[model samples]
Target: MAKGKKKKSQPKGKTITLKMAQNSMELTVDGKRRLNLSFQEIAAVPKCLQKLCEVDELDMSRNLIRKIPDFIDQFVGIRVLDLHSNYLEELPVTIGRLQNLLVLNLCNNRLTSLPNELGLLTKLQTLHLGLNQLDTLPASIGLLKELRHIGLSDNRFTRVPGCISRLNNLQKVNLDRNPMLTEDTASQESVMISESLYVVTESFLCEHCRKKLKNKKLEISNINKVQFIAAIVANMFLGVKW
Candidate 1:
C-alpha cells in the first residue's frame, strides 16, 4: 500500500479555479482538470496535487472515499473536515496530525473503528460519526479535553463506549439510533464514573426513578416528602436512617 500511496505533501504546478474563505475552503476536482479525478474518487489529496491552500473548513461530502488520505496531515490549519455521505471503510492513523481540527463529520460511511491517534487532537470540540459501521471507539478518545459534542447515531455499536463519559466538557450526547443501547446497565454507569467519581454528583441522574430522566425529572414534587417519610420510619424502628 505504501508504494501506491500518492505523494500528498508536495505542491502541484497546475493552475485551477479557486474559491476561498478564512475558515473554510472549497476545491473542484473533476476529470476535466489535469489532476484527472473521477466522480467516484475514493481520495482527494492527490487530486489537488499538494497545493498550499489553507482553510479552516473543508467539504468533500458525497464522494466515494474508502479511506482518509495519509496526505491530509499537511492541513494543520483546518478546524472542520466534512466527509459525510461517502464510502469510507477506515480512517488514516495520520488523522491525529490535524491538531487544530474541531469538527469532523464522517456520517453515512462504512467505518469499523477509529485510529488510536485520533485522541491526540486535544483541540477537537465536535465529532459527528453517525451512520457508519463502527463497532467500538478508541479508548484514547477520552483524552480530548476540549470535546463538547458527539454524535453516535445510526451505527452497529452494541453498547455505548464507556470512555466517552470522561469528557467533562461534554454537555450533550446522542445515542438515539443504536439498538443495543438499553436503559439498564451496571458496567455502563461504572465506566462513566470510574474516570471521574466526583463528577457523578454534578451529573444529572434521577433518584428512585427506574427510567432515565430529562430536565423535567427534577420537577418531581414529592422528592422531599418521599425522603422524609423513609427517614422518619427508619429512625422510629431501630434507629436506622436512610
Candidate 2:
C-alpha cells in the first residue's frame, strides 16, 4: 500500500493567529522589518500598530480608509508609507511629523487639495498624487528640496506652478490628462522634458497642437524663401547696366 505524504510542520516560533494572517497583519519579530497591511479592506488602522516601533515600511494600500488617523504619527521609524487607491479626501496634519519618510504614495484618491503642512517632510524623495482632484498645489511645496519625482497627472491645474521650477533636484513630473493647458504654454514647457528634468503632458504634441506648430513653421519658411527670391531678382536687376 502507498503511504500518505506527511504534512509539513509549522516553523518553531510564535504562531500567527488565523485572523492576523488573513488580514496580512502578522508581526514577525525575527528581523522582518516591514509591515504589509495592504488590500485588507481596513477602514481604520489597527491599535496593534502602536506597538510596532521597529517597522520601517508600512503598506496600507487598496483599503477603505477615508481619513488618515492621527496615530500615524507614532510610526516614527517608518521610511516608506503607501496609502494608494483609498477613499481619503484629506490627510491628517500629523503626517508632516513623519520626518523619516522617504516615499509617500497617496495616488488615486479623492483629495481636492493638500495641506500646507506637507512641506515639513524635508526628507521625502518621492510623492505620488496622481488621479486626484487637485486644482492647485500649495506654495509651500517648494520647501521639499529633496523631492525627486512627483506625480500630478489627471489633476485640474491649468498651468505649472512657479514653485515647481524651484526644485532643482526634481527629476520626473507627470502632468498628463489635464485639459486646461494652452498651446503656447505647452510648446514652451515641452523643453523641460530632457535627460535631467522629465515632464509628461498631453498638450505638448497632441494632433491639434502639432498641426498648429507645423503650419506656423511652414508659413515662416515660405515667407523667408519668397523674400530671398525677391532680393536675388532685385540685385540682378541693379547689377545690369544698359
Candidate 3:
C-alpha cells in the first residue's frame, strides 16, 4: 500500500505577535491609519499594540481573544475598534480610555455585561453589541449623546433598554431577534443588514475568505466544518458579497 501524506496541524489559540500586527497594518486611501488583524487565529491582543500609538482604527475581530488587556487604554487616538466574533466574556474597564472613538463593534461574543466606563466614549457615533449573551447594558450607555446608530440584535433583552429612547441623536437602532422583539424581527432583518449593522470598510470579511471561499483547506480537529459551510451558504443566499 502507498504511504499516506502526513496531516498538518491547524492554527488555533495563537497569540498575535508585534511583527504580525505590523504586517497587517496599512494606511487607507482616505488617509485613515488602520490595522486589521481579523481571523488570524489570535487568542489575545498583542502587547505591541501600545507601539501603534498613532493608529486611528484597529480591527481584531473573528479570532479567539478571551480578554482585552488593560493596555487597550493606549489606543486613545483610535476612532474605531472592531472586536466581534470572538470569545470575550467581558470588556476591561480600561476600554473607556478611547475617548476619541467614533465606532465600536462587539458582536458575536460571550459577553453578558459591559463596563460602566464604556460611557466615556462621548464622541462615539456608532456602537454594535448584537449576537451576544447580554440581557442588559450599563446605564452609562446613555451618556453617548452623539451616538447615531446602535445594534442590539439577537440578544437576551426582555424589553428595549430605556436609555435607547433618550439618545437624542440616534438615527437608527436595531433590536430584532431579541426574546421580546421578534414579533417584528423577520421584517426588520433585511433593512438592518442593508442600511445598518455589520459595519465594514471592504465588502469581504477578509482577503483569505475572498480568495479561498470554496476550497480553503483546514484540519478538522478544532473546527466544525458543518457550521462553516452553513455560514458560507447563508451569506450567499442573503446576497452578501462576502
Candidate 4:
C-alpha cells in the first residue's frame, strides 16, 4: 500500500433517470397527484418533493433510503405513502402531520420500533409493517380508532401486542412467521376480515373527502355531511387545505 494514496470515496446516493421520472411521476396526470419513485435505488428522499404540497400518493418503495426526512409533514393532502422494501431503521417524527393519510405501507424495512407520533394518523385504515424486526408496538397505537387492517408478520414478537385488542374496528391482522408464537396463538390473533376491506381500494376511495367506509352499513351521504363540517373546521384552524 502506498503511504500517500487515499482510497476513493463511495457515492452517497443513486439518481433516477430523467426518462424514468417522466414516465412514472404523476406530474403529467391531471386527475391525480402521485409520485412513483419506487425501485429508483436512491439512498434518500429527493428534496424536490417538498415543493409538491398537494401530493395524494408518494411511493418510495424498493429504494436504499435509510431515514425519513422531517419535511414529509408538509404534504398535508397525502393519503397514501408507500415506503416498502427500503432500508429504513426509524421514521421521522413529522409523519404524524399527515392527517388525511389512509394507507401507510412500511413493509420489508429494518424498523425495530415505531415512533409514538404514529398514533396521530387517526384517519389511517391500512397499515403494513410486515417483514420488519419489531417485537413490540407503542401503546399509542391504540389511538388509531379508524384502523381496520394491520400487517405485523415476520417480526420478532413473542406475544401479540396488547394494543391490537383495543382496535374495535380492526377486521384484518397478520402475525405469521414470528418464532415465539404457537399455532394456537396465531389462530387467536389473526382476524377474518370481510371481502369489503379488499374491495375498497385506495384508488377507488373518495379523493378530497378521504373518509373510509368500513362496510356496507355506512352511507356515503352521511359520511360526507359529517366529514365535510369537520373538515371545514380543521382546515380553518389547522391551515390544512384538505
Off by over 4 Å in 2: 1-32, 183-242
Which portions of model 3 miss their true places by more than 4 Å?
1-12, 181-242
- lDDT of each structure? 0.68, 0.78, 0.82, 0.81
Candidate number achieving the greatest TM-score relative to the actual structure: 3
lDDT of 4 by residue, 112-225 (tens): 999999999999999999899998999989999999999988888766789977887887777767655446774656433222212223444575535444443368667888
TM-scores for every candidate against the unseen true structure: 0.61, 0.66, 0.69, 0.69
- By lDDT, the best candidate is 3
lDDT minimum window of 10 residues, candidate 1: 190-199
Residue 230, candidate 3: Cα error in Å is 58
For candidate 3, the TM-score is: 0.69
lDDT tens digits, residue span 45-65, model 1:
443524743555566677666
Tell me model 3's lDDT, rounded to 2 decimals.
0.82
lDDT of 2 by residue, 1-242 (tens): 99999999633323334357445544546654677877776776665667764577888889777888898898887888999998889998889889999999999999998989889899999999988999799888899999988988777766677777777778778776664555678474432221222463435467987788789999999999999888888988899433
Instruction: Report the Cα lDDT for residue 214, model 3.
Output: 38
Q: Estimate, for each residue in 1-242, the C-alpha lDDT of model 3 and write its tens digit.
A: 99999999554577767787889898989999999988888887777888886899999899989899999988889998999999999999999989999999999999999999999899999999989998898899999999988998888876668877667778777877766633567654422222233322223347776555434445343267787878999999999886
